[model samples]
Target: MGMSVGPSGGGGGRRRGGSRAPMAEINVTPFVDVMLVLLIIFMVTAPLLVAGVPIDLPDSRANALEQEKEPVQISLDAEGQAFIDDAQVSMDDLPAQLEALRKQRGEDNGDAPQVMLRADRSLDYGKVMLVMGELNRAGLNRVSLVTTGSSDRP
Candidate 1:
């Protein structure tokens, strides 16, 4: 029988540095694929990550204002159900809940706590104003209405 020689010119023998050169080239296709998948997942989930209750916010041409501190989030759904942050509370208890929250944040004696109110687009104007009145009577004077940016410019 005759022996065959490999590319290294060895007679069925292993090369000094081994068969493969430790794979000098890196496979970037998988890396790129994983990165693209992660990007798509983030894009799909980023909108759902917003805190507080979900509601159809009305479009507004008014410019958004910046705040110095984290404001209290109050939401009113289409059914007029009130929520302080994510916890549901009746309209009657809204003031007390806000007071408890203010006391916990050490804002009872300090600067007033800012309030961000999100009301559904389908909610009645009078209902929204009623909640605003409640907030005012609770000593939370600084309030900002949260609305989506309108595509049309005034």
Candidate 2:
């Protein structure tokens, strides 16, 4: 003889023949993998970031002078190729180049082009110093070094 059982006290109803319910928890591995992939993509693309050219300038403790206008960026790569505001400027043409650069900034009140020197630390200080001297000779007395502001520094 077949015996009939009793009803279970569990909250939900029991299905005689049906598919089981799926788990509530979400699969996180795919999300994590996607996140990691995104991180890697960003890392790979980070170096491709266009900057105002790279220059390894020396560290200085003195506060930089305030500029009323944006200063021209001069970069000195390790090879000693000098760049004035991203333009390849020869040392001999520095003064004349700066004159034009100053005019480009508008309102040429005979004001010197504010120069910001960015030289590689490995570069010969002679080149950077020579640029400074030439800028001075070109009548650009205002020069500054671009650095991470202490406030913005990590």
Candidate 3:
């Protein structure tokens, strides 16, 4: 007598018969991780990109002013030395440089460019006034004093 062992089909129907197809679903976990790292790097380096002369500014409770254009930056360090946007300029040459800048910006059309004055807190009042005097002589009358915001505020 012949004895039957069992069903002997290919793969025994336990697995798919054909080769597996390529995976249609994409893995986004790695892509998201890379993007997050790039964002963090930019956040850390953004503030350092602002290049300017450093000086100790006094804190004020006054609100910031609205600006229509990029203002000129004039800084005075603790030694009473003046700088025009990070360039060390002698007090005697301040007017000529300012005048040249004013003319180059075409301020004669009546739209005066604003000037922001930054003076160290330790500087004497007279020194600050002297810079202001130079600004006025250069016909830059619309001036604003730059001060840091008070840290005690909520």
The prediction achieving the highest lDDT against the true structure is 1
lDDT for model 3 comes to 0.84
Model 2 TM-score, 2 decimals: 0.55
lDDT of 1 by residue, 1-154 (tens): 7656877665857776676646688889999999999999999999989976879998898888987878889999999999998999998888798778766764646766889999999999999999998888777788899999864855
Q: Write the per-residue lDDT of candidate 2 for residues 7-114, one digit (tens) a residue.
A: 544435565444477679999999999999999999999988755677655555567676777777878888888787667877777778866665676354766667
Greater lDDT among 1 and 3 belongs to 1
Residue-pair clashes per prediction, in order, are: 0, 1, 0
Using alpha carbons, what is the TM-score of model 1? 0.71
Best by TM-score: 3
Candidate number with the higher TM-score (1 or 3): 3
- Model 3 Cα lDDT, one tens digit per residue, 1-154: 5554435444434434355666899999999999999999999999987637878999888889998778888999999989888899998888899898677764567655798999999999999999899888888888899999855765
TM-score of each: 0.71, 0.55, 0.74
Off-target runs (Cα >4 Å) in candidate 1 are 1-26, 106-109, 151-154
Query: What lDDT score is found at residue 80 in candidate 2?
Result: 85
TM-score of predicted model 3? 0.74
Q: Model 3, stretches more than 4 Å misplaced?
A: 1-26, 151-154
Residue 10 shift from truth in candidate 3, angstroms: 25
CA lDDT, every model vs. true structure = 0.86, 0.72, 0.84
Report the candidate with higher TM-score, 2 versus 3: 3
